[model samples]
Target: MNYTVNQSWKILLPLSHLSPNYLHEHQLFQRQTGKSFLRKIGGGMDKFPISPEILRPTIVFDNEINKVARALGLKGKRMPYETANGTLNVNIHYYFEKYIVLDVVFKQRISFGDISLLQKSRLSSYPEIESLVLAIAGLIVSGNQQSYSPLTSIPTIRCFSIQSLDDNQFSNMELVEALTGHIEPTQRIIDDVLARNSGHQTSGPIITLIDKQGVIQFIPNKPKLTKDALQKYSSCCNLLELMLVIEQSIKDGHLDSNNVFLSALKSLVEKPEDIVKSYTAQRTIKQYSKDFHLESRLSDLTKKIELASSVLISEKKTLRRGWDEFYASNDFFQVLFTALVAGLVTGFGILWAFLKGL
Candidate 1:
């Protein structure tokens, strides 16, 4: 039975980290409904049907356009057109309920001439086109969510294009191949950014795609690295050494092993720079050296200091206890000694008197 395409049938591409069971369930749902999946597009088309100039410029923008189309419940079609730029594959999305069409043009490198050309396009008269222009401008400023707002609420025909200098790295065939899930176009962009910014202290600009709601639709999740794994890859020597110290503290019951290890691992992964800075500062202190003898001496010194404090406290407690006992017993020992001394002196006086009389 043929099913009519509806809003419910709108397809969402699987996130790279989706579980296999979720993917399988989605496949089953598609089969049961006899609905076409988004990934099936371009599979039956002739490979590289368009010129490389047009394909490369447009393909990088497809991921964002696809997300926008899906979110707005619009169906997308690739139409071929001839321009001075080359044979452009313009994507048109039809919103049946609103009776609106959106024309998305992509220029690997946009120029003032290109903007003028787009202004002359047939759909330029629509009010939505102005919003589309602003949205595209926002995207160009920073390929991030802060640049754009949702355009789906504008219920009219709209036209926009992405202009970027990085369009040359991909070709039409590669973009078409990506549609069939044979390659990940988003990952290619990330790899390109990383390649361009290799060894740089600053992070590269993050390329993001937004939906009609101005929500970021494409964000790559960094791989979660474990403590052991991070130690193996750490560039700072002190991180691993500190991990050893923390581990020893855990073993000696000075720290909660699970909590401390997790916290350390998180900080190492999320804020390695902070850790490196702290480690560098500690290394500057002579007493913080990693030499075994030095470390042992420091540990021994800590123990000796603690022992001296305990001894002082114990002696104070013993003296206080003795004073309390003497007061409570009415000084019996003191009185007995005094009596013995007095009796001896009296007997000696009596013997002297007798000797004198004789």
Candidate 2:
């Protein structure tokens, strides 16, 4: 669960491969399982909690504590050597990791005046949000093409965060500097270097964002990554928008529709007051429409709300149907596995006859 090199400057992060379709499939499985006949694998990614302060606990590599330790013959152990241009290529790993430069982050606590259900959910939600956010860094890394993808570009700007335990407690400056040192140059930087040299080989440009929120989401500054606008393990606000985002995420090998759907459900459920609001909105519209405009306007508004609700309900059904087909095919062993065995026998007979003739 935790890997620590030094107790003083240790980092905490979760371990998830963030594979494509995992979250979506999980959502489908959960829904299917809730049904009378079908089985369920688990709930989707949306079941994961959300938080306000996303913390991606990452240690700084530019500080190169390991090299520093070695040079000064310090007793403490630093992980491996991680130089950008060094033979070991530490900078590349940090670049892919999208680690937040720890030099600027500091933590301050706000007291909860009193405890209640709202306070509890709000407070408990943060750590969950923080955990999920860290996964984003890995997700972004997985999305990078130039770093190691056929479908992605080196992220123009990679973002992460470092949390100081307390105010003025940022004693890890050396570590911070060492880690910052290894942050990779971006393509823009490389082009600039090339321009300066008139086409000489040089480093690329790199952008880094550091937030004191303590959230671990490794957001990229590039247009594509920035445009994603997806919540961690949650679906997008718009189904089409979410799908487009998921399509890209899938290409980068982080598809998770299951999580997206679960996120969808979570979002839908969050608005219990919506049901009340819907009635209120309808009444408000009815009251206002009686005095002004034609029947066409009332009809149009009704049609629009009906259309919105229909779309949401239909989308849910469509997701269910897709799962039905998906699970049926994927659960080959759960279905007519005997048919597969019979086909094997039939094919073997044909092959055996051919072999005998030969």
Candidate 3:
């Protein structure tokens, strides 16, 4: 990391012995003639138009990358190399003892053809191509970069489609992946870089994803337990009890039998947050069961009340009809009794009058 910055001329001097024409052409190319020269050589096939504004930033970016390469103990040089398709502007070359890392950056959108050409440019004999890092941005006016699926299969080459080259920025993971080439070491480097950049120490490794927009999104290494799961877990006495319940539910087919969900639950039992979530979910289920039982009871009571009311109404109607029928049958007897009472009263009155005359 403590290497001095060597001049570009000094680096180009060594390449003179290797390829004089390549060295001279590359040196001339770096001095602002590279793009035009490539365009002329391309003969209308490669349409990479460079704006003045972009050209300045690209030069700065190239210089910054050379510094980074030097810091990593690799000799850096800017060169325009020939490819099968046409001439490509290989901006930065990092020379190591065993292999050479070539960096090709484009201000305009890069095509799959460009990538294929770079892959073909690899020399079979001398310094093996260890890594081929291609960085491109701006509008993709032509072929789809996604069609080059074979690039992902190759471990050495890395393709980064960025938003812009203003910051010359790269994700911590990208840097680590390009440098270390191992997962564990790359993760360690990522954590260290993140901790240094943020100025705050982190306990565990940070997982990151780069979006289509070239934005770095950090994903938490640990899984987040849900509130419902926490509630369910609270009802359980301990983790082991929760695990037993889950196991029984799985065996009885009460829970979803999807292996993925079951596997997630099994993994969740180990985490304290997940246990709390489980308790919350259990409590919610219990509440729902109680409410359902109450509803059922109310429904049964209503049905019974309706049946009794119907029976009582039928009985009252029958009693009223019976009384009406009795009145109708006793009508003749009621008239005969009235007539007898009247006749007796008249005879009594006549008898009283004769006694008074005597």
Q: What's each prediction's TM-score?
A: 0.18, 0.18, 0.19
Question: Which portions of model 3 show Cα errors greater than 4 Å?
Answer: 1-18, 21-89, 92-103, 106-179, 184-187, 199-358
lDDT of 1 by residue, 1-358 (tens): 1111000001111112212222122211121210121111112111211101111214434454445444433345322322333333332221111111122432222343323222322233333333443343333223334234533332222122221222223232332222222343466664543343233211122221111111011111222322222221121222222333333343343333244444543443344444433332223212123322334533544465567779999999999998888767967678778889999999999999999999
Task: Give the TM-score comparing model 3 with the true structure, all chains together.
Answer: 0.19
- Candidate 1 accuracy as lDDT: 0.31
Cα lDDT, model 3, residue 324: 74
How many residue pairs clash per model? 0, 35, 17
**lDDT values for all models:** 0.31, 0.28, 0.30
lDDT of 3 by residue, 1-358 (tens): 0111100000000111222232222321232323332222223312222101112224444553344334433443532333232233443221111111223322222233223222222222112122222221110111123322112112122222222212233356553443233443556666754443342112223322211111121222132422222222222112112222333334344434244544444334223233223333333223322323423433444455566778899899999988778668867577668878888888888989888989
Query: Candidate 3: deviation at residue 94, Å?
Result: 13
